[model samples]
Each structure stands twice: as structure tokens, then as C-alpha cells.
Target: MNLKKHYLITMIAILILFFSIFSILTKLFLNKGFLSIEKKYKDTQINIIQTLLENEKYSLSNIVLENSYWNEIYNAVENKNIDWINNNLVYYFSSQYDYDFIKILDKDKTPIINYSKYDIDLNINKIDIINSTFKNSQQYTDLVNIDSNFYIISSSPIFDGLGNKAPSGYMIIADRIDTSKLENLIKKIYNFESLTFLSNKNIYFNIKYSTYIPLKNNNNETLGFIKIIPKKDNIKDYFYKIHIIFLIIFFIMLLIFIYFMNRIFETINSKIKSTVHQIDLISKGNYNIKLNSNTNIEEFDMLSNSVNNLSKTIKEKIDENNKNYIEIIEAIMVSLEVKDSYTVGHSHRVANYSKKIAKKLNLKNIREIEVAALIHDIGKLGIPESILNKPERLTDDEFDIIKTHPEKGYKILEKISYMDNIKHIVRFHHERIDGKGYPLGFKGNDIPLESKIIAVADAFDAMTSDRCYRSKFNIDQAVDILNENKGSQFDPTIVDCFIEVLNEDMEFKKSFAL
Candidate 1:
């Protein structure tokens, strides 16, 4: 992937993972924290209900104790005034105090009288319970379930109002838990909404924010359970709301970050492409093409400026080197003209003909062929002036010496690094397409294209020019000689192209007008 897409995907993935983990961790933290808060609230409500129930039991016990201390009740119990006991005690306590049941028992633990407001079954085994629980105290209180009804029971011993006599009987009073004031206290004062009385069997193990208060007899037996539920906690909902808000904010931030990142990448990518385009143009010899180095990015702008500077410097150096190379070539030509003036003219005509043929063939870098043609006979300078400008035909040995010029020209141009490509063209210019000519006898396609063009131009110039052997041939004779030797001594395509150039090209005809 490109920089923009790769960076975008990576950042998106990282942010998503971070948010996912953050969300999970936040949820877990909230759950743990809320669980602790709910538990504390539940415990607090349970403690309040326990206090309310205890207060109720205490109030009932106090009522029983006051009634037990009445001398009238004590005297009545002593004299066995059953009617007085029934009318005064039962009617007074039951009607005024909302007691579910009132019971009077003798010191021997025999029940003397029992009155129930609701006429519930009084099958309680009170003697054993009273004796077992009152062995240590004269007053007692307990929560009991009788006939499927839960009650808070309080018992105290009857005594003389003078405070001198022992107790005559025991007074026990009870209030059913359902009709008791505890429920109203829990609901009104404590602000609890749900209160339920459940038998031990009906009590559930799991209840939402519900507290269980057990009602037990004096024997510590659980008779029933009280369930109280408080209001639902809204903190979890609030926390989630806040978490959602944070997530939305984080997502918006991520989008903003991506937008800015895309802009940054686009800027960087555009600058790089612009720099690369300028460098490509320079590589293709368009050194005059300038790069815009004013991009906002510092490093890329610096690189662009550096590239522009390098291109300018290289172009300047190349121009200076080219001028020096032309001066050297001219100086060499002057020396060659001093040795054999004819050969110097011959080199110039060959160079002109090679340029025309090269252009006619649509060859690339026509300047390279022109340069190679100009210097193709540079090695002839090594030959004696007698052989170079001889007025007669050369012997076999002298011809052999003349043929060594191409190799000498290769040596002369080899030391110049800029002429490396055309040096082989100079060495192989005398080679024939039939493998009959040259130092290495290279055949046909084995010869460089520039060398083949120079060979045709050289032969044409030699045929038309005055030579040590004979007078120069006429234009028609020269054309016929080139056509006759097309595939043997010269590249046929280049020879044909040169003949067409001589006939059709106005520049060539004017330059060589006979």
C-alpha cells in the first residue's frame, strides 16, 4: 500500500483497538464500582429495617412489662377474677394497643386466660418456650410464626403495684408482623418501596437489591423472612451515558486526525512526484527543466533545490567539456592538414556525407555519427606523408600500412572518456559487411551501426576524391560503384540511403554540387 492508505489503516486499527480495550475496561470498572455501591446501600437498608423491627419488639415488650406491673392485674390473677381479667386486660390491650393476642399464664406456666383479636388458633406450646427463654430474665421478646402468620411477641411477669410482692402471672402480648407499624416506618421514613413477608421456604436466594430479615422464635428457629427492596440505582445508567459521550468524542477526534493526516500525506506525495518529474526530465537531457522547490515540506523542498542545483552544475560542466573537446578535435585536424591536406579535406567531406546519410536513415544521435566520421581517418596521421599523399598506386606493403590507420585512430580516441561509445566506430569503420575488410574482419550485423554508416561515407568519398592511385570517379560512376559493392564492402541499407540522399536531398546536392 501507499503511504496514505497504509498509515490510515494502521492508525485506524490502533485507535479502534485502543477504544475497544478502553470501553471494556471502563465497563468492568463501572460494574465493579457499582456492585460495591449497591451492596453498601442494600446493607444500609437492611440495617435500618432491622433497627425498625427491633424497636417494634421493644415497644411491645415495654407494653407487656407495664401491664404486668399493674397491681389490679396482679390481684385479679391472685384472686382468680377471670371476668375482670377478660374484660379489663383483654379488651383494653387488644382494642387500644392493636395486639393480635393477649395471654395470661400462672407462675407454674399454666395459661390462665388467652384472648385473640382475630380468633386465630391458639395451639402454641408456650410453657416450655417461656420456661426455656425466661430462665435468665423476667421479660422477653421474640418474633414467632403461628398458623402461618408472623408475630412479634413480648412477655413479662405480673407484679404487685406496691412493689413488695412477687409476680403472680405472666402477661404476653403479640402484634402480627403484617399489621405492625414496621412496614409503614420502612416505607414512609426509610423511603423503601417494596416490603414483603415470605416464609422460609418461599424466600428466594437471589433478589434484586432486596434484603431479607428473618423472623425466628426464642429457639432461634427461622419461621419466615422479610424482604425489603429499595430504589434502583441510576449510577450505572449515568456511567454508560457518559461513556457513550466519550466514545463519540473520541471518534470525532479520530476522524479529524485522519483528515489532517491525509492532507499531510497528499502534500508529501505531491512534492515527491514533482521532484521525481524534474529529475526524470534532467536524466533525459532536459537540464533546462527547473523544479519548483517551494513546497511547504522542508526536507522535500531541500531535496528539490539540491536536484536543481546539481542539474545546473552538471549542464555547465558538460558545456565546458564539449567546448574543450571541439577545440581538441580542431587542433588534431590542423595537424592532419599539415601532414596531408587532401586527407583533411577528405575527412570533412566524409563527415558531411555521413551526416546526410544518417539523417536520411532516421538514425538516432546523428551527432555521434558525424563525430565518428570526422575522426575515422585520424590514424592516417601515423602513416608516412609519402604513402598518404603518394602521386601513384601503392604497393601491397604500402596498402597494408595504410589499412592500419583505423586501429591507430581507435587508440587516439580511447583516452577520452566522452568518446568511448564512438571509439569502436572509428576502429571498425574500415570493416566490410562481407567480413573481407578491417583489423578484426567483423561481418554484417557484428559492426556498429555508426561504423557501418561511416564505412559507406568513407568509401563514397574515397571513390569521388582524387587519390594517390587515380583521378576521382564521377557522380554516376561513384553511385554505380556503391550499388555494385552494396552487400560486400558496405551496409546495403546505408548505401541505398546515401544514394537517395545524394539524389533527393537539396542540402546534400548543394554542398556537393559537381
Candidate 2:
């Protein structure tokens, strides 16, 4: 009787261990599977929203272009016919076309006629005409934020009767994006819980579970975001039900074969427990962990070998991924260089100069600083190549468009979570030390140290490199310029460090042909 009791106790312990291991593995697998399914669904919904927004912008552009290209409208605006303007542009177009706001601006961008369906005032002075220049006939669309309200704005130049010469003025149309309109559209198309349009300030709310997609203009600058809050579903409950059913079957099988299967079950359970522990270590980023299989069971040995191989494979893959990431960054730099002849090899030189300055200052994370310097002008990709390579000085409107590149670069790099530390450096590299720099006018110490370092390097490279508008400056001339604007335009310390670095490395200076 005592022997039978001992056997029963041993069988019960084995069964408990088996059930515990099974439950953990099942839970891990099920959770991963369900999460993947949820991600796919959410991604699909976000893509739909992006497509819908693009289509809306396209439609708005078409509407504005139709009115702007009319010869009669162009002649009326040029001749300053008040009766023609009021009857056709103000009353007829505003009422029949159903635009929220319609305005005609002269060559100076001053409004000739302003009409609004809503109470919000229109600020024509703040409107950007970078993409709507008379130099080209292309229609431009932008998401404009005025007084905390967003609008889809389209601008097209009004050409003369001959339709061949420069435009006399611009015809502008805007459609407001209100909460009711957004909610109605979401319900009609997505059938999701709700869609929220968020500004940069409110983007952090419910970030983990919600889908936050950046809304970009025709220039690819991020204007705002579309946040999708998905309706909750029973994915977890379904997986839980499946797990319970499997556990029941497992418990029944163990009970039926308790006496006969005791020794075999103990061996299998021991091997599985060891495997699980090693896998857990690997999951926790300990790729060095390994398992040993001496059970003499073919299946157990194969499983052990597979786990070891997986660890080795994972390590190799991680190394390869790191290498590939760096290569990709370099490739992007090369592509940017290709876009503007003046900036060819500009990023590489800036990176080299930044690294030297960083070393002189004994800054931490020097590699990150170098990488940021290399891609400092990545946002220039969004700027029109014509503007980037334009030989003449930029107009106020053109410079405003140029100033948007830093923010554009920030948006692009922020998408890569691992690049968070360096992204700010890329964004603020153009910032002035005196709080006069663009996108965000951060002052003095508010600018990141890495950005300060890159700013000096970027300026040095620009001065030394030949541009479309001017020839390259000699070493003394470039250094003098840096010394001249040290405190106001650049961090004085970083500028001094770079100057010292250039003096110390004769070979590097020779490479620049200084």
C-alpha cells in the first residue's frame, strides 16, 4: 500500500510540472499570434485613411485648377473689373462651387477678393507660394493650419489670355477639415470606433494601442497626424478558449496513461523545462545561452541542436542587420548628393568634420554625432531640386520652403525608433545659437550639443564647397567667416574646437585642398 501511494504521489508531481510548462509555452505562442493579426488589421485601416486623404487632396486640386485656368477669369482679374469679379468669382463660384474659402491674389500675393463660408478669417500673407510660382504651371496643394483650424488648400496661377506668359495672380481654394466632417467620413468608410486628428502636442495620447500616421503635404512635410482608435475585439478570449480546450485534452491523456507513462513523461518534462529556460534567456537578449541534451532520445537531441543553431543564427542576423542599417544610411546620403550637384560628397565631408570636432570636445556617442552630420541635410530631399540648385538668391517665400527641410528630416528619421537620439541633431543642425533658427526657434543651451557640433561642421563644409551661386572659399576666408559669426550663428565653443581640429590635422586639411 505504501509503495502504491509513493507511485501515485510521484505521478501527480510529474503531471503538475508538465501542465505548467505546457501552459507557459501555449500562452507565449498564442499572444504573439494574436498580436500579429491585430497589427495587420490596424495597418490596413491606416493605409485606407492615407489613400482617402490623398484622393481628397487630388480632387481639391482639380477643382482649383479648373477655375484658375479660365481665360475670362484671368482677364477680369487683370482688368480689375469689379462687376465681373463680384458676379463671377465672388457670388457664382463661391455659392455654386461650394468651397469653404475662395480668394484671388495679385502678383504680390495681396487678396483681390476674399470669400469664406465660415467665420474664420483668412490670412493670405501667411500663405506659401513656393510650389505655386509663375515659373511653373503645376498646381500645388497644402494642409494649412490657421487659428488652430486645418484646411486643405489648393493654389494655381492664373495665366493670361494667350495662356503662354507668366501668371497675373493666383486663384486659391480651401476646404476646412472640421470634427463633424472627419467623424462622418470615418463612419461611412472605415466603420472604426473613431478617428482623431491630432496636432504635434497631442500625439502622445494612447500611442501604444492607437495607430498614429503622419499627414504629409505635397512637399512631404508632416503637417499633422491621423490617429485611429480601433474598436476592441474578442481576440484574447478566443485564444483563451482554445488554450482551455487543449489543456483539458492534455490532462485527460496524462490521467489515462499515468502508471505506464511515468518514467517517459519525467524524462520528456525535464528536457522541455531545460529547453524553455534557455529559450527564455535568449528571449531576454542573452544569445549566449545554450542547452545540453544527454537524454539519448532522438527527438530531444534534435530539439537541443535546433535551439543552439537558432541562437547562432540570431546572433549572425543581428550583426548583419546592423551592417545593413549603416549601409542604408550611407546610400541615402549618396542619393541626396545625386539630387544636387553642388552638394555632391557634401555629407561625407560634414561627417568627417563633425567626427573630428566631436573628438576634440571629447563628446560621448561620437558615432551618433557623425551619423547625424552625414544626414543633416536629408530633409533637403523634400525641397524642390530647382530650389536647391537655384543660382540666384532665394525669395522670402522660397526661403520659407527651404527652412522646412530640418523639420522634414526630423519626421523622416523619427520613424526609426533606434535613431531617436540622433534625429534631433539632424533636425536642429541648422539652428542658430541666438534663438533665431527655424522650424523651432530653440535658444542657446536649448539646442542639443550634438546639433551644435554638426552646425559648425555643416557651415564649414558649405563655405568650402563650390555652389551654383558662388565659388568655394579658401581656408582662411571660411575660418574668418566662422570667427565672425561665432556667438550669434553657431556655438562658439564648437566653432573654436573645429578651428583647432582643422589646424591640428594638416593631412585632413590637405584633403579639402585648403
Candidate 3:
């Protein structure tokens, strides 16, 4: 991806990371805090209900104790007055106290008075259970389950009103915790959404934060559960709304920040591209071109100024080097002319002929061929003057010495940096098309094309020029010699181009006239 896309993606990633961390924090601390508050509130409400239930049990125990301590209750039990109990006692207990069941038992645990509003089982077995339950404590006030219904049952020993004698009987009173009572208690506590009594299943909780209150009997056996679901908390809803608003504001802020950052980076990117374009021009040797200096960024402005200075310095150095290179070539040519005056005309005419042949052949490096031809015999400086100026045919040993000139020329030109391109041409000019006649016998196609062109030019110039040994051959004889030597001594294509140059260009042909 490009820098802009990468930067945008990175910014978006950071934004997402920030929100993720915020969400985790909310879950860990804030949401947990709300949950903790809800738990405490539910615990408080459950405690209130539990306290009210305990108070109801205490009130029931007080009523049982007061009734059992009365002298009339003791006389009624002792005299066996069922009619008196029915007329007075039942009306007082049931009408005033809202008692669900009333039972009077003698000291021997035989029931005397048994009155119930809902036909509750007052059987012998149940009576035995109630007696057994209060035999140890002598008093009972607690919840009990009868026929799958919950009730508050209270029991006390009956005695005389004045001086308490041995207890003559026991009095028991119970108040049922029916649906209306539970509903009234809940309505007094808080406005709840719903109330449900659950069975033995342990998993009773549902959505909307329901509170499960288990109802157990005096024996601690679970009878049922009361589930209270309160209305949703307005404060919690308010907190959630605030957090949503904050998230929206944060998102808007992030977008605005990214937009400004994108604008800034766009300016920087434009400046960078401008700077790179100028540097590219400099790399391609457009030394005269200047970098844009008006980029407002300080670093880019400084870089532009530095590159401009560097370009000026490089262009000056290159111009100075070119001037020194021309002087070096002139000095080498003067030295070669001093060594052998005949080579002055011979090298110049050979360079002229090589240029014409290169142009006729449509070769790109015509100047390179001319340079190699001019320096093709520079290695003759290493040859003895006696060998170079010999009037007669050279013996085998002397011909071997003459053949070393091409290698010597390459070695001399290799030291000049600008002349490195033409050094190979100078070294391989004498190599034949068939891999013969060279210091290193490079064959056709292996020889540089500039070297082939110079080879044909050098031969034509040498054959047409007068030497100390013999008079020079005419132009036609030189051309015939080139045709005969094609593919063996001279490259056939270069020979043909040279012959074509001779036929077409009168100036080049006049230079080869005897």
C-alpha cells in the first residue's frame, strides 16, 4: 500500500484499539460497578422482606403466648367446654387476629378445640408432629408447609391467668401466607414488575435482574421460591446514554483529527514528490536542472539548496575534466607524431575513413570508431624506431614485434577514464574475422563493431599511403585488396561499407588517392 493508505489504516486501527480498550474498561469497572449496585439493592430489598416476615413470626408468637397464659383458656381446657370455646374463643382469635387455624390441646396432648377456616388437616398424626416439635423448646413460632401451602405456626403452653400452676394445655395459632398476603407485602415494599413462586428447580433466574427468595419451613426444607423483578434502573439507563454520546463525540473528534492529519501529509507528500523528481533529473545527468527551492518545509528547502549547490559543483568539475581530456589527447597525438611523422597523416586519414565507413553502415558509435583509429597505432611508441620505419619487408621476429602494438595501445588508453569505452576497440582492431591475426584471437561477432570498422579503415589508409619500402597502391588496387581479404583479414560487412563510402563520398575517396 502507498503511504496515504497505510497511514489511514494505521489511524483507523489506533481508533479501534482505543475504543476497544474503553469498552473493556467499562465492562471491568463501570458495568461491574452497576452490577454491584444492583446486587446490593436486591440484597437490601430481600433483607427488608425477610425482616417483615420475622416480625410477623414474632407477632404470631406473642399472640399465642398471651392466649395460652389466660386463666379462661386454662379453665376451658380443664372443664372440657367445647361450646364456650366455640362461642367466645374462636370469635376472639379468628375475627381479631385473622388466624387461619386454632387448636387447643390438653396436657396429655389430646385436642380439645380444632377450628380451621380452610379445612386444614388437624389429624392425630399432624398433632403428634406439632407436639413433638414443641416438646423440647416448650414454645414454637415459625413457618410451616401444609398441603404445599406456607403458614406461620406458633405454639405455647397454657397456664392460669393469676398464679401460674403447672401448664394444663397447649394453644396453637397459625396464619397462612396466602397469595393476597404476599401480594400486599410486595406492594408495600416497592412497585415490582412481576412476582412468581418457583418449585424445586434451582435455576430460576431470568432476564431483567430477577431476585429469587426461597421460602423454607421450620425444618429448613425448601417449599417454594419468591421471584421479584423490579423495574429497570433509570440511573443505569442515563449512564448508558451518556456513554453512547461520548462515543459519538470521540468518533467525530477522531475523524476531524484524521482529516487534518491527511491534509498535512498531503502537503508533505507533494513536496516529497517534487524533491524526488528533481533528484531523478540529476541522476540522469541533467546537471543544469535546479531543484524546486520554494517548498515551504524547512528540511526540503535545505535539501533543494544543497542539491543545487552539488549540481553546480559537479557540472564545473565535468567541464574541467573534458578540457583536460582534450589536452591529454592532443599531447598524445603530438608525441606520436614526434615518434614517427608519417603516422600523423596516416592516423588522421584512418580516423577520417573510419568515420565515413561507420556513418555509411549506420553504426551509432561513429565518434568512438574515429577515436580508436586515431589511437590505433599509439602503441607503436613502444615499437623500436628501426622496426616502425623499416624500408624492407620485416622478418618473422620483427613482424612479431609489430603485432604487439594493439595490446600496447589498449594498455595506454585503459588508464584514461573517458577513453575506457574505446580501449577494447583499440585492443581488438587487428583481430581477423576468422579468429586469427590478434594478440588474443577473438573471432567475428566477438570483435567489437567499432574495432571492425577501424580495422577496414586502417588497412585502406595504409595500402593507399606511400611507405619507405614501396610506393603506395592506387585506390582501385586498395579496394581490390580489401575485397580479396573479406571475412579473413577484414570484416565483410565493414569492407562493403568502406567500399560503398569510397563510391558515394568523393571527399573520402580523394583522401585515399595515390
Cα lDDT of all candidates, in order? Answer: 0.71, 0.73, 0.71
Better of 2 and 3 by TM-score: 2
State the lDDT of candidate 3 residue by residue for 1-514, as single tens digits: 9998998888778756765664455334545544544555565556556544654665576566657667887888888888988888888999998899998878787889888889787553564436664575366777776776677887777778743587787777889887678778657445578777666656556745677777866566777777777776423554475456546645654565466665555564466466556656664567798877786654456556656765565466455444544444555666668767579778888888888887887888787788778878877766656567677899999899889989988866653445678888899989999998788999989998888888888888788888877888999998999999998988888888778878888875775573
lDDT of 2 by residue, 97-138 (tens): 567887777766677887788887766556675344444655
Candidate 2 backbone collisions, by pair: none
Clashes of 2: 0
Off by over 4 Å in 3: 1-12, 127-129, 133-137, 199-209, 234-253, 256-514
Following a full C-alpha superposition, what root-mean-square deviation does model 1 have from the true structure?
54.5
Question: Residue 484 of model 3: what lDDT?
Answer: 98
**Runs of candidate 1 exceeding 4 Å displacement:** 106-112, 126-128, 133-137, 189-193, 217-221, 229-514
Worst 10 residues of 2 by lDDT: 233-242
Candidate 1 lDDT, 1-514, residue by residue in tens: 9986887899678667765665565456545654554454455455445545654665576567657667889999887789999889888887887788888887676888977868676555554445543574377778877767777877777888755787787777778888345666654434456777788675575565566766666576888877766555333444455556546645664565466665565564455456555666665667787777675554555555555665565466456445545655665676678777687588888898889888888889899889888878877666666677788888899899899988988876664556788889999998989999978999989999999998888887887877756888887888899899989998889888888887787776656546
Q: What's the CA RMSD for each of the models?
A: 54.5, 11.1, 52.1
Clashes of 1: 0
